[model samples]
Target: MGLRPRMAISDIEVIAPHFKRRLSGVTSTVVQLIPKQLEAGVKISTLGPGLPDDLPKLRYRDLLQCWVRPSSGKKRIWHARRNIEMVAGIFLRDVLRMPMKLVFTSAAQRNHTDFTKAMIRRMDGVIATSGRSGAFLEVPHTVVMHGIDTTLFHPPRTNDDLFSASGLPGKYAIGCSGRIRHQKGTDLFVDAMIALLPHYHDWTAIITGRVTAEHEGFHAELEERIAKAGLTDRIVFLGEVDDVKLWYRRFSLFVAPSRNEGFGLTPLEAMASATATVTSDAGAYAEMNVSGSTGMIVPAGDGDALRNAIEPYLADPGRAKRHGENALAHVTTHFEIGGEVKGVSAVYEATLAGER
Candidate 1:
């Protein structure tokens, strides 16, 4: 798509508190090249705690503007608070001094009535990642769905290769990948897995991720439940793998049991990886998942519903494969990297032009 008339897009910066190495290799690479591709004479910069000291510096004049999404803390609640404070400090002090416009990514960070009202008041525009988030903000904003690297995530030509590498033949594998914590609803997933064990003996659940000390007690409880259910052989914990794509390719089905999300990326990744997904109908899953098409959605925290949703796939391999194919098609058409960049760039151009 050509640039809108009279619109001039400028330098773009993404401020992720902690960037994932996997995403940096693909999505970040595309993000870094957007300005050049758009021919917008833009320079991009990233600033974070982990930013390298040896990274090239940009003078004030060379920079067009700064967009900041402050880093969240380890504890979810504390993290939200820290993010609010950081935004206020940046907008009230530094951003206000500059002639450039300010854009924020989240309502929790930009529109919190108690904490972020001042920051919201200062921003030129707010770029929401989902319609639900935009509604929560109750502000003028554009909903831009985050993009995935479709090239990296597209459906494989042959499942034979993936299956051979996985070493678990003729068994249905249900996989979940993300942080192991209360907010993610990992407990609910475990309960669902437990419920499915008696009837589905050939089924296995693969959990991949680490748990923090704050969640150590919860982790122990989960382990105890797995032992009590006698699912030691059925449930495998792979921990955190360096290459998520490998595991994604190996999965027969992908499950996301999150309670809330700004815009869930894992499901999109799973969809791109061509895995049938069963996700909780919470947060952005409602938007990302196409019920009975791409994947099934059960009510959040309902173990029975989760089990029921997943049972069909375990019983029929052909149905599961069809669902996975649909998921890949959906993601490729709607959530690819180029589409996401264009959506975000439109918001930037609109804000700069004072259209919103």
Candidate 2:
């Protein structure tokens, strides 16, 4: 069940396809879920590139075996999270006449294009990452929220551990991680830091994420703004690191200031790291956060609202600490990776049972 590919063709109950070669959110989700799903007793295997060698996998040539009935006498479930994967699943099932059922998992909250709508209609079972995403689907689907790996994102040993690791001139470190672009609300986080950091000397801001070529101008302008405010030292940028989960540990407070998102995971990751968050109401953020309990939720794309939500944490470090504790407890109770594996397995079970 650990790292070994399920080589026996008859043993595979589910086939998870990742058609894209680039490392994306979908790729990360597949990489994280498959091992946990296998450990949970789901006979699942991945297909395609960009995945680690350890996980259970199948070669492209092995797809020929899909035509043979599984030993269980049930159609193998083909789980897809992207359009290209869905199309490939359709071809395998319809054109090649494979003994398989197509299952599509959608995380997008927007209305589907005509092509996507047609593709979804052919799915034997569909899963949505959040209720908001489910609302956009014209077909019936199960809402299965994303979960984090708590073992990799646990809290630090001491309250000062965040400052100790960073060695920055502050008692607390505020953090935002993801791609640096307007859609991700990098500018909003910077503006909030510029407005609030001067007043709160104990707190410093850290941004960790890649600044892609297209967003270079946007990144430069934010730097200009921070310099003009003369708070460049307080608002630091650590552009794109591999071990972001460690950076999550180095945060007294986390922020996900996206103007738009598709089931944002940073807030959940932050919560699992025992750091309270101030996230905008984008993607499933409102679903993950309990306002004033675990963390605050501001209106998306509103800089003033974002600033107001963050000011409370700066004004009262003790309250932030309490909220961080609450966040940890909430995520541990409801958003562990095991819970996601179980929910997805339920869908596979029902689909295999011939329930639409």
Candidate 3:
């Protein structure tokens, strides 16, 4: 595929591996085809704790003009210091020589108030991932919805071999993907699964992703709760997988029980794979899921609501299939990767052209 005009995005912290993969995949594909189009470059390259050092290097001319910011001592308080660092970094590294337009992705790694003020004072433009996130910034920022690789996440074309292979043949498999942490509300998902176990015996819950050390105790606690609920035979925890598209294909239903998300992309991926979804009304879930139109949404942190939202689908596969088909159609129409690239490309052009 040919690259559109090049624009650099900051926020190098791989807070989520999937997020990093999407960013790198999208940008690199565009850069490969139209290397010269990337006149405006990205900076602030920070990596995750254990990310490989041999990652491929980007070659846009403006990329050579960029520099990464040094992280501070109190990493948890990094957001509070990020605005100051961003302003200083921009002036010293990007603005001293020439006036190049910038398109900052996330907030300045600081409190919303501080980050908004910093953005207003520093950046030439902004592209927020969701309306709620954009609202907090209170800038002339555009709500640029995230995109998914539909080709990679499309409906399964093969047989249900994986279901039988995982010993779940003839049973519905509900899957949730994300870091197994407190903020993600994996405990809530566990609670819901526990509640549903007595009623639904022909269903399994598959949770995938890595668990943080800070959440080790919580993980243990959840496991004990699952065992107590006698769901050991019903719940499967598959640690991080290289290809999540495969997981989505195998799942009959996808659940996003997160407490907060800037803009949940997992549901979009699942929808693309033609998997019905039940997400908490957290963050951007409402915008992504149309209640009964695309998929169902339950109140955040409410295990009962989550369980109820999922029970109907578990009882009726035909309705679930209809919801999944609708979801796939809805996401395809609204969140195509080409549209995302075009929209972002427009932002870059307008920014560079100084078209407020």
The prediction achieving the highest lDDT against the true structure is 2
- Please write out the lDDT profile of model 1 over residues 1-356, one tens digit for every residue: 33223221132332223233233222333343343334443233432333333332333333233232223211011001124434633543374553444566662312466556566555566766677767777567788767777766666667653654577533667889887888788888888788776687667788888777788889889989999988877777777787677777777799998876556678988889889999997667888899999989988877778878988887886787899999998988887767766776676667667766
Q: Residue 208 of candidate 2: its Cα lDDT?
A: 94
Error of 2 at 297 (Å): 0.5
lDDT of 2 by residue, 1-356 (tens): 34674568788889998888866778778877887887888888889998888877899888888899878898999999999999999999999999889899999989999999999999999999999999999998898999888877789866544566677778889999999999999999999999899899989999999898999999999999999999988999999887888888888899999999988888998999889999999999999998999999999999999999999999998888899999999999999999999999989988888776
Q: Best-fitting candidate, measured by TM-score?
A: 2
lDDT score, residue 150, model 3? 79
TM-scores for every candidate against the unseen true structure: 0.79, 0.95, 0.77
- Candidate 3 lands at a TM-score of 0.77
TM-score ranking of the models: 2, 1, 3
| Candidate 3, residue 129: how far the Cα is off, in Å | 1.4
Error of 1 at 137 (Å): 1.5
Model 3 spans with C-alpha error above 4 angstroms: 1-89, 92-95, 107-111, 160-162
Clashing pairs in 2: none
Better of 1 and 3 by TM-score: 1
